[model samples]
Target: MPSSTYLTPRLADLSVSERPQERLESQGPQSLSDSELLAMILRSGSKGRNVLSVASEILQESGSLNGLLKWSDAEFRAIKGIGKVKALQLITIVEICRRVRERSPVTAPILDSPDLVFDFMRQDTQNLEIEKFWTLCLNRKNRLIKKVEVTSGTASNSLVHPREVFREAIRQGASAVICAHNHPSGDPSPSAADIKVTRQLRESAKIVGIDLLDHLVVGNPEHDPLSRGYYSFQESGLL
Candidate 1:
């Protein structure tokens, strides 16, 4: 094996000709690899490993950038060389990325398409270990205003309430909202409780003047919710 003291040639290790920072400054962020982008966040490696090695380990263990974002702090900390501080650091970076994505211009015109709803929610909610209810507040034009986490739990109806859903919509001056939740079991099949909560939210939105556009249940694409003939409120005539 190579000497444990050898520092890996990560972005930080490159000279002005080879570094990601230099390349990004001269070229652009798109010029960098996934590991290079992640290495930039990692900054430095532990004693034996360099940032590239650390980034590789993270990618390998987590499976992908999406997988990295999906990992809990506890799961990240379980990595051989990662500790609590590093785990927090990794999660914080992911959180910032999420917020930035959330705040990005809604240049893409919103549609009533359930696929759009699924794509939007998949950016953050798909791989959560616990159930989380999210409300996507939209303007009259159907453009996104904001996305809020209403509640989190194991069961859909256990934590989500109509009051909490509409309160934020009213505060944001939203004309409509889309309710969504993720299934960690990789089945996007909406439960009976999901339907019940959605019905309640739809009624509340009616009373509050905020239209309920749709309620989407998301699971991993690998699992084939649609092909598996999972529940879609629109398809089921529940919407």
Candidate 2:
């Protein structure tokens, strides 16, 4: 028989200072990195790699936490170190986020200012690989009623149409709407196409008796790799 004894060491081989669990319990969750937080949920790894390494690898494989939101349960389990329980945990988190996003938006402040609007949406689209167009529909009081994603794709073509934007706004009974999109290029500067599309949507809104309040472009204004900075057309008087 081949050597039955498993010579490979386990996570215990690492010092307590290097262990995610110990560090977390001692230092608190906020002190840890994203991988450490994820590793806490994962709890274990494959025979050779430890939980922290597994979590770091998973983050790299799936991209950021936002990117992980796109993965399926099977995809999570398919990773070498993750198993059924870890996969279920990850899936549960994703479903909870989905539910959170679906709730009504009116509880928040009126999204009248472009800066406020950008803050409202940067979470969903900032680090995305592709462009995404969103509409924030608001009531007469300017409180948000619903936020909808119209389209997503490459920078050149997101296929955002006035019909899609207004149809949702009308369905949501919104008196006015705010438009927003992210530029993966990290440049918040408006493209000629961006200006043209905003004007088109504004005209359509006028005809439909719905107001187009502002259009926002999200990007990395600070040139920071980890942050998705933004720009506002209304703030710059381009809308």
Candidate 3:
């Protein structure tokens, strides 16, 4: 068996020019490779392996840095040298990244573009361990007013309440709302339950004088709704 020492050298051991943090400080984050960026989070490795090696292993196992967010704590700990502390650290860091991405400014209005809608939703909804139903309140011009979480549940159901959905929209004085949810399975294809929820929300919005702009099912990049040809109620003339 290959000893863990076979792993890559430590970030600190590298020359100043080659270190991820040094490179990031001097050249910016975009200049670092995915493993290098992750190395900054892992910080240190097991007794035998260096941080870069552990990060590389994690990225290789996960297929990408973002993909690591999909892993549960237990799953992450099951890796060769990671333990509970490392697992929690990884989870916390990923969560912070998700939150930061979600809160980032939306300079442009979230128009009818499904891609833009997906971009906004993916910041929080993507890589979720369970299903989450959320709404984006929009003004008449389709500019984003606020994003609110309506419900959360297991893989099959988000158990969203129509009243809760509209309450925020009304409070925000939104003229319209776009409902979005995610599948942990990475498939954005709308399920029958998803369709039922959309139809319900649309009818409720109508009764409450709020327009249901669209219902978007968000998933991973590989299973992107727009790319995979998923149906939207507005586009199908069902609304």
Name the weakest run of 10 consecutive residues (lDDT summed) in model 2: 1-10
Regarding lDDT, does 1 or 2 come out ahead? 2
Expressed as tens digits, the lDDT of each residue in 71-147 for candidate 2 is 99998987887888878989998888877877635355688786678678868866788888998899998898888
In model 3, how large is the Cα lDDT of residue 189? 74
Off by over 4 Å in 3: 1-108, 224-226, 229-231
For this target, which candidate reaches the highest TM-score against the unseen true structure?
2
- What RMSD, rounded to one decimal, does every model reach? 10.2, 12.0, 11.2
Ranking by lDDT: 2, 3, 1
Candidate 2: list runs displaced more than 4 Å: 1-106, 224-228
lDDT per residue (tens digit) for residues 1-239 in model 1 = 25544656434445786676677788889998888788777776776677777877888888889887678889878765678888898889888877787778757558477877776677686457888878888998998888889888874333688998888889999999888878877687777788788788878877888888888787776676455312457656776
Q: lDDT (0-100) at residue 196 of candidate 3? A: 83
Candidate 2: count of backbone clashes, pairs at least 3 residues apart or interchain: 0
Task: Give the total clashing residue pairs for model 3.
Answer: 0
Candidate 3, 61-145: lDDT as tens digits: 9998778767778877877678899899888887887788887886856566677787667678746889988888999889998
